[model samples]
Target: MGWRIRNGMSISIWNDCWLLGFPVRKVTSSQSTQVDLVSDLIDMDERSWNIDLINPIFNEADIESILDIHMSNSNQNDILCWKGEGSGLYTNLLTKRVSISNFCPRCNQSIEDNTHVGRDCPYARKVWRLLDIRWSDDASNLCFKEWLLRLFMTHNKGKHICIAVTIWSLWFARNRIICEHQYPLFVAIVQKCRMYLRHFSIRTHVLAWWKPPLEPTTKLNFDVCFSYAHQKSCSGFIIRDSAGFVLGSGFIHTHHITYVFMAEALVILQGVHFAKDIGITRSTLESDSKKIT
Candidate 1:
C-alpha cells in the first residue's frame, strides 16, 4: 500500500508508506527518536521539502523518491490505498471482476495467476531467458511470491533489481499485447528493464567528487563545450597532481565542426598533446561524455 499525503499531520514518518515503493518504518524507531510524524519532513511555511532535514536521514534514492512524490492539493485527509493494480485502487470486488479470465493471455495455456504470469507463462519465460536469468524446472512448483522471496534471499541488490524489474516488464508487456494489441520484442523488454535498473543504481550510488591519481602520476580531466551560435567548439582540460594540485590547464578553440563526436575526438587528441608537451609520461584521462569515454 501507498499513501497520498494531504494534511501530512496524521501520517507517521516512521510508520507510514508515504514514499512510493517503500514500506512503513523504513528506518527503525531506535535510530531517530525525534522524528515522528510526516509533517516533520515538510516545511509548513515554504510548502516544500525540508532537504536539510531529510538529506542526512535518507539515502539518495529515498530522497529523490520523496521529492518526486506529488502531494495532494485537495486539503483532504490523507489516503492509504493499495497501489498494486496500477490504478491506486485494489479491492476484492475489482479482483473478482478482473480474475474472470482464467487462461493465460500470452501463451493461451494454463490458468492465469501470479505464478503463471510471472514464471509459467511461455512469453515471460522467454524474456527471462533473453535476460540470461536462470530458472530451474524444479522451482516451477513454487508460487510466484515464494519464488520471488527465494530470489531476494539468494541474490545481491543488483540481481534483485533485475529480477523484480524484469517481472514487472513482462507483466506490462502482456497487458500491452492484450489491451492495445501491441507486440513488443523480448529483447526490448530486457533492455527496458536493464535501463531502469541502471538509472536506479545511478540515482542511489554515491561517488566522490574527484580522486587524485597515485604518486608521480597526473590526472587529466577533459571536456568539450560546443557553441551553436558560433558553429564551433572549445576543448578544455585540466591537469592535476596526486594531491589534486593544479599542474596545468588549457583550452583550444577548434574550427567549425559538423559532428559532436568529431569535436570530442579532436579535444581528446589535443588533451593528449597538451599532456605530452608538459613532460607528463604517466597520466590518466577522464571525460564526462559517455561516447568520448
Candidate 2:
C-alpha cells in the first residue's frame, strides 16, 4: 500500500521507515522517496528564511515535513489579483473562494490573471519599465512555470528575497487600486521595495558596518599614502605592527584633488588623526612623498 500523508499533521520518512515508527526493510521503491528528501534539503539551503505565501505546489504532507508549515489550497486568485504580480507568495492572506476572473473591476479589459496583472497589465508594465525590469512580452505567451523556476535557480539569497518582496509589494498596490478605485503609481511601488530590502538586509545582518580592531605597535614605513585618484584626490593609509604585522587599511572619499603634494599631506594628516584616535602616541611616520617627509 502507498504511504499517505493526511492534512493537519507532519512527518518524515526514510527508506520506507517513518521517522516516528518502526524501521522497515530497505525496499527499492523507498530509494525514490529518499531522493526527494535529499532534493528538499538542497532547496532549503538556497534560502535564509522561509515564509509560506500560499499552498505549496507539492502535496500537503511533503510541504509540512519540509517547510514546517501546514499546506492547504484556499483558492487565492482574488488575493493575487488584488496584489500585483510577483507578490502573493510572501504573505499569509487567504485566497478568496471565488474564481478571480468572475468579476473584474477593469471590465473594459479581460479578467486579469497572474500573467495578465503581473506582466501584461498596462499599469504594472509601466512600473516595470521605470525600474528597468522587463517581464515577458506576452502574459499568456511565455512559459510561466519555466520562468518562475528560473527565478528560484538564478537569484542569490539576497536578490531572491528582493524578487519575492517586489512581487508582493506590487500585488498590494494593485489591490489598493482595484478596491479604492484609485490610480496606481509606479514610483511608489519601487520605493516601497527599496525601503523593504534595505530594512531586511539590516535585520538579517547582510548589510553591516566594518570596524577594524586597533593596533598599538604597528611598524610601517608609510603611515599614510596620499595621491590623486581619478579627477579627485584621495587619502589612504596602511597600518602595521612593529613586527611588521599589517593591522588595518582603507581610503577616504573626498572631492577632486588639486595637486599630488596636497594629497600626500592630507593622507599623512588623516593617518596621524586615526593613530591618535586609536591611542597610538608615537608611530613611525614615513611616506614616499619627499614633500611630506
Candidate 3:
C-alpha cells in the first residue's frame, strides 16, 4: 500500500506507509525526534519535495519514490491506496478471466503477459526509446510489476503519468491492430499520451488572470472553437488596448481542420494577419491553450 499525499499534513515520515517498497520506514537517523509529518520534507512555497533536506536521510530509490508520489493541487486530505494495482482502481473480480495463453498479438512473440506488453516487447521498447527514457537493455529478467515500479519510482510525477499513459496507449494500439486491423503509428501514440498528460496537469493547476498590456501597446487575444460532429472550426480574436477596452474584434469560420492543434495554429496565423490588416503594429498575442501559446 502507498499513500497519495494531498495536503501532506498528517502522514509521518517514519511510521506511515507512504514510500514504495515493503515495510515503509525512513532511514535510521541519530536525530530521529526531529522528523514528523511528510510536509516537513516538502517546500511549501514551491509545492515540491525538498531534495536537499531529504537526500541525506533516504536512499536514491526511496527518495525517487517519495518524489514520484503525486501531490494534489486541491486542498484534499491524504488517502491510502494499493500500489500494486496501477492507479489503485483494481478489484479481485476484475481478475477472474485469467487467460493462460502466452502469445503477443502485436509481435507474434511466444511469451505474452503484462511484462512483455508493457516493457519487454519490441514495440513497447520503441515507444520508450522515442520518449528518451533510460531503459536498461538487460531488464528482461524483471517481472512486469517490478519493472513498472522501478521505472515510475525513478521519475517525477509528470513523467510517471506520461509513462503510464504511454503504456496504456501502446496496449490500445495493439488491440486496434489485432481487432480493428488498423495500424497505429508510434509517434501518434506518444503524442496522444503527452497531450493527455498536458491536459491533466492543466486541469490540476489554476489559470492565471489575463493582464492588459502596458503603455501604448495593444493585446490581441485569440481563441478557436471546434465542432467535431460538423468537422469545422471557428476562430475569434479581440484586440484590446492598454486600458482593457476592445479596439476591434473579428471572427472566421473554416472547414477541413484535422485536429485541435491544427485549428489553434490556423487561428493564431489568421489573428496575426488580422492584426496586420487593421494596422495594429504594437500588439501582443495571447491564448489560453498552452499548445497555442
Candidate number of the best TM-score:
1
What's the lDDT for all of these models? 0.68, 0.46, 0.68
TM-score against native, each model: 0.39, 0.33, 0.37
Number of the candidate with higher TM-score, 1 or 3: 1
Per-residue lDDT over 4-36 for candidate 1, one digit per residue giving the tens place of the 0 to 100 score: 465577677765545653123243334466667
Residues 147-232 of candidate 2 have per-residue lDDT tens digits of 55565565566566666776667666765554334555778888887888787876684334323334554533333333444645
Model 1 regions more than 4 Å off: 1-82, 85-100, 206-293
**lDDT for each residue of candidate 3 in 1-293, tens digit (9 for 90 to 100):** 34556567757776555664333344344435555788888777777788888888777767787877655553333444322232332223215554433467668874766677677778888888888766565555776767777777778765876787877787668656643456877788878877887887876664456799997998988888898778788887877777776666666667777788888898887776666655678899898887865
CA lDDT, candidate 3, residue 17: 55
Which has the better TM-score: candidate 2, or candidate 3?
3
> Which ten contiguous residues of candidate 2 have the minimum total lDDT?
75-84
In terms of TM-score, how similar is model 1 to the real structure? 0.39
> Model 3 scores what on Cα lDDT?
0.68
